[model samples]
Target: MPIVDLGSIRGPEGPQGARGLPGLTAVPTDQGLADYIRAGKDSKTGQALDLAPLLDKPTILSNSRRVYTINNGPWGAALGAVRDGIRDARILVVSDSTGQGVGGSSMDSFPQRTSWPSFLAQLMDDLVVPTAHGLGIPKSNSSAQPYDTRWTLGAGWAAGATYVGFGGKQTNYVAAPGSGALVYNDPRVYANTYDIYYAVSNNATYGQLTAVATGGGTNTVQTGSQSVREIRKMTVVAGSASGNNVVQITNSGSAGNVTIVGIEPRLSSQKKVIVGNASVSGSTTSDWVAYHDNTVTNGWNAFSYMSAYQPDLVIIDLGINDAIPSAQASVETYTANIRQLITAAESAGASVVLKSMIPSVAARAAREAQYVAALDSLRYPFVDLFNRYGSYEKTSAEGWMADDVHGNDRIYQDEGRYMLQALIMSPMSLAAKSVTIPALPALPVEGWSERWRADQIPLTVGSDVRAFMSVARTALKPESTWTPPTLAIGDGGRKVVRFNGTTDGLSLAATRTQPHTVVVLGRLRAISTAANNGIVGAGQSAGSRSSLFVSTDGKLVINAGVSLTNPAAVPTTTQVFIGVFNGNNSVAGLTGADTAGAAGSEGATAMYVGRLGNTGMAQLDVEEIIIYPRGLSSAERTSLTAALAALAK
Candidate 1:
């Protein structure tokens, strides 16, 4: 019965079998992005829309995000402090040759222009606004403000350094004779103290050091503790406050026996960001965890004694060399050792970020992949850059690489920028906010300030956002040529529209309500040189305008002329800006600052965001904009401030 002409047993197509639920008709383009794959769920209606995006590349676990927002305790402080103009933010990057930005599988003698650490330091330096008291000392301009100042005295770990006996790129190999001194006239920034890393070649000769004054008034005995070949650090404090930035180190006559390997100078009581790089070529995690046991041939030990010194952040860039086939570490061992490094850093009051191994040569690709994927267990701020970057072959074809193991200047620069954006845009954990918003209940609150809510557009970057919807699901369209602002991802993975200071533009529809209050949640990317940086505006021109802006001297202005400068405010940081228009009684509020004066007109017939005609184009990033039919009461303003402040962070 079963075998009765089965080939001819195909009945009349069986009514198409109900069409089999649309056959998953999603094309490759529907997969969202090439690096990410999409999955859909059944909804009993027509086709189910895209539900979730599953990463299609290598990563430890989905939980190990590009940045660990929650666990980034110290990192968040460092990030926030730097953004807030904190004076003393330091980062220590311990890594192998890749950390040094040396392209090629093997360590090179010179450095490429774009190392992740250098990029990190530069990006951080950009945010630190210069004040009368503080100037950001970055590792960016090396010749102008060098970070790694080595001695040219000895071989071994001191190879990278130059002897300061004669100022300039240390070329002389001789030490100061007798009680004479070798002075390091630091050509960089002015500093009060200096970190001196040295190795003793022969008999000990590390002696007194005096640079506080030219007259040898105050000289202290040096640390002088030296191992056979281990790199040791000695902190030299200024004897007095008013000498030049010259460090005079004296050693008993042992010729070039006492060699200064590295010099990191600290500004006397001044604030700056110094990224100390302690990286050796072709070193691994094992080499780091072991105190003085770095591969002898790989040069200086890139290890820092955390107990004596500390940094705001510690970026551990290992696993690249560990993935070498001959020296391949077990994934478990790699995971455990990485944890060990994290513990040491965190225990020292510093936040840690893990750099996943980059793509390696074909021979070590598989092992490198294992080392990268093993980071899922670390649960720290992980830079899963290897996967986000193109494949080895694809990258090699791009001409951004010198060898399979190292990317050239261009690729390294792009990678560094990519890595930097990942790190800076890390999601801010809710538990870490200084102000906790009194939890709001389901919508339609007692005093609803927002006429529109939940205006979530396509989460994809570069996707056009045509219209935003109100609570009633109706739409508010922008001008014909205008739509979504220049979309970008800001800190905390928040989708925002960033204005490019000079050219970018976007506008919102004119206000519909007569007595309207417009609220904007955003921050300026920088302090504009313009007299005023427009945020939101209405009316025809500057004279007859209802607007909110940042004044030249860092004042937040509302529709009714500039307000009294708030004592407890920073115009550059994120703020909840409110503008109320009601003719003469119109008012504007910025966090705690408020001003009451006459607005050009009421009802806000015309409106714009991140732009004010042509002259006041804003260079800022905006997260959300809400409008209410009328002015917010004092209590409502308080509640809104708390709610918006919580989001601002």
Candidate 2:
């Protein structure tokens, strides 16, 4: 960093107490934003970047209207959280006919065919992780009985009921007082817990009244008058496979417009991985983006609620429909729309993963190129199934294609399983397992090579932490146990190693010279030590020396030869500490803020971590440490600090 002659810009020294930079409490560089979306490792942080939403990373994806955190949350630290048992993962499949599970079995309807999302659910083993949620949307299961009969409309029902049942649009049956009801078959074949979701504006009550001569259950519900179409779920029927009214809603005299959103059935036997397959088969990014603010009662002409499923990670599988248009204008529109959808999903605190779909016709695949490129440019987690599984023709060669556009059950199953598997084997996920500091961009102008990471330390109590990047580098022989703190973010399952402050310490192999940079990702266990607690310091066996340590008064004192004292610099929690020293020019930075000063000839001795010379041993939790043997420029230091911050997974 440059030592500027501020005499030119200086007005006058303010009063007697303030002349230098004021000490700042620890400041996080960014507002905790993740870096990658494609399945890979970020070159900057050397941490995993993913093609799925890693809720743990908590990155940002901002557009014109809002900014969003792509956290794979309500899920877990990684993708396919259900398989990992992080949470019973809620996956909302927002696709088209493929999402409807159409190509499987015979070319029949929604009931007989298993959805493509079901394949993914089966792969995630969601069937075994029972939760209170399940997916059987009314539109998907439109047919009632007699092999082909739709729900029979009763009296007082509007002609629009035809549009709702057959046409899966936001338009619902506007029933007048005591109107025709949606009656099911006698034998409720797939009987489970059925919930009728609706939104009534201007105070309306709807549900089954008394079981008249028609034979239906007697259950009524009163709704409030709300401005927005707030969704409501009423468990209309809970029947058995032994013949019952699947769900007969004899509207309980609703005076106002009772907009029926949709019906969802939760199968008791299949409550593991709650899969909401509301994918609009012939839709694109534009269609889904249009649903950003849309709810069930006023959504697309499909059986999907954009965010109501409460997914931890929204795997947006688009491109085929968007790519179908052969104009460049379509690609730009697609890019904007997809970002809006991502903004919507992220707005709900759900991480988003964009997956590319197959266009089928070889020529249409070319049009998809711009779409894929556009998604890539957006830098969201994008899974290129077309590229990953090879072309449709190739997949068909492997007998996984149902036709030109859709994949067979086998291939679809593979796609589902691989999505989670990709998350499992992603570089981001695996990096948390070991050698976490390898990819951090610490090697600037300094040829310094010594580096060590505490996160990779084996969980075994007494294991020693060694330096990677080079075997000959000094190892930290811990006198304390290996227990990483619960909140160490990016290290995944691994944790920080704690020092008990007694004999717990580590030393550099050789005494360092004048100019060097040191960065430590750690936290102080105890403050208010009488003697300086050396975090990583060098120079003789006593006195101040040149160090980055907690001073006798509990301040984070930084110096090259001349120590600067600031009480607030004391860090009690986790932080990234950076110190640069080169004779009369030294800079100390904690978190994002920094303070620079004149450096004396200190910091030119062997460095010791967790100890000040021989006296003040520190009680600390160490996550990572880096020593670059040269003075870093301001830009490199800033870049390095930002990269380190992204390490919080």
Candidate 3:
């Protein structure tokens, strides 16, 4: 039987023989052989097949990523870099420039050449709201009024009088009540054409009212209805004035009533002082744009020139020039300019820092001394470089200056160090180490007094908002406790709590029943896009639960499960996350318009802030929370949206 089929003698397989124990099997597919060849491993040792140590690696790196087994470790030692895993290569250039120039030139030179900026650019890890100064200072023509004051005559402005004409141009007033003396408070008022005078309070300078005169021969200068002094002969050139001649009423010689009227302000070029910057044009360099207001040839308008850097912190060193004219100058004016700059900086979302003028030698010190004193009295973050360099000495050996005005090289270096130190020592900078939350945009409390405000809890304890949630560190589930997220400084420079989405959350008492609206503002992280991920939830049962959640697809679902995925998906990069529910409709984040239809209704029992109960743990960062008894109208919603957007930005 074994020798049978030779050539054409193949016999029909006699009853297919039983398959015997599938002997050493031939690979059924080509993959069998390919797999063995592709198994990159040492055949005998079973260890990963090692490639000959890489002889060379890329010396340059860029935005495109590349992997390499580095030799000569971090410090460039072959032995040090001998590691197992490959490193994602990147190029980082460090500079050690000490900066240039000295004295007055140093201010401009130091920023241009200093390498610290590069370092700072690298260390700016987390996204934080740049510290800003208060609201911007109003300019002569700004739409916004930094300061406003109105005094109507006992009767009113010439019946239907609206504005006053100076040099054929109408000078308008900001606002006027029904009846009172029309007094002006425009800061841009100038005496170049006509002498200008105003009343001062406690020598503080700001909030002064311009004077009015009536009698022809020797008119009495009066602010509002009160007489202050007398103007000898009303004189005018009938042309445009260069700068305002601000006169202090207490020291003036006017007590007559002149037809004085408040001048309305002109609008700012674009409502900001710094012209070009990252926010305006997209350049990232210096933190601030240095400027001097109304200098020779450098008009007030010229002060608007901006650099590429959008400053989060601005340090202004002024007063030296102003004090030089001490005989004709006042400390009040110096401080007024300082405040204006501060307000402008704050308006731009930059923290304000002021530096006193460097000390001067010889007779100039007498005038600068008073300026220094006044500068120190200001209630702001101040750095006194004057006193630090000693009072005043004529010789370069005794002072930090070669001349009476400019500082020497060492002086400049010291100033730069002090500036850095001042920033490092600031409370804002200190808090910046962890997280910096900006202030929340304030809601219009105008009609809030009438509406029944049940509860407006901030959920923050002092500066630490870790207790923002109802449940502190307790676990949502029975066995697993959650690690409460830490507090972070949020947009608008305010305290906020971070929710791990797993166990971090807050529960509030039910203050509103039906026809109520709840608003939650925070940053969300979409980790596990499981269904029913709670952002804000409260209800009797799952079906009727009023909750805002991230759907399984990472889209924002709000108001009883009504999903609004217009934004496509919330970015993982923590951004402004807003959720709103108005009993009937709901909106999530900055998505499509409100979704019509009833969201699941919840009983007026309790409200969950971040996570609802245990199952719907929301990975979030809560910046603010609000619950209104009544549903908000479309207009109100729009307003709220605008306000919240401003804060988040």
Residue 612 in candidate 2, Cα distance off native in Å:
55
Q: Tell me the tens digit of each residue's lDDT in model 2 across 294-393.
A: 2223423222233334444567777765655453337778787776666445423245667667546676788777777776666555556656554667
Q: Rate the local accuracy (lDDT) of all candidates.
A: 0.49, 0.49, 0.35
Model 3 per-residue lDDT at 95 = 9
Q: Model 2, which residues run further than 4 Å from truth?
A: 1-72, 77-89, 126-133, 138-177, 183-192, 202-224, 236-245, 267-271, 291-307, 326-329, 423-649
Q: Write the per-residue lDDT of candidate 3 for residues 1-649, one digit (tens) a residue.
A: 1111111111111131122111112212223222332343324335332211111211111112111111111111111111111111111110011111223332332221112221222111100101111111111121111122222224433322121211001122222322344432223222222223112112222122333322212223223432111111122232233233221111122232233321212121111111110110110011111233312122111111110011234555544444444442566665665555444343222344455655665556666677667655654555565665555562256444645555554354344433432332121211111112222235852222111110111212332222231101111111113334445555456455666666565443343455665565566656565645676676446422666666667666665444444345656543434444554554554422454455544444556656665567766766555565566666776777667556566
List the candidates ranked by TM-score, beginning with the highest: 2, 1, 3
- Candidate 2, residue 411: Cα displacement in angstroms equals 2.6
- Which predicted model would earn the best TM-score? 2
Q: Write candidate 1's Cα lDDT for 406-429 as tens digits.
A: 765555544454444444433322
Q: What's each prediction's TM-score?
A: 0.44, 0.46, 0.29
The clash numbers for all candidates, in the given order, read: 10, 20, 55
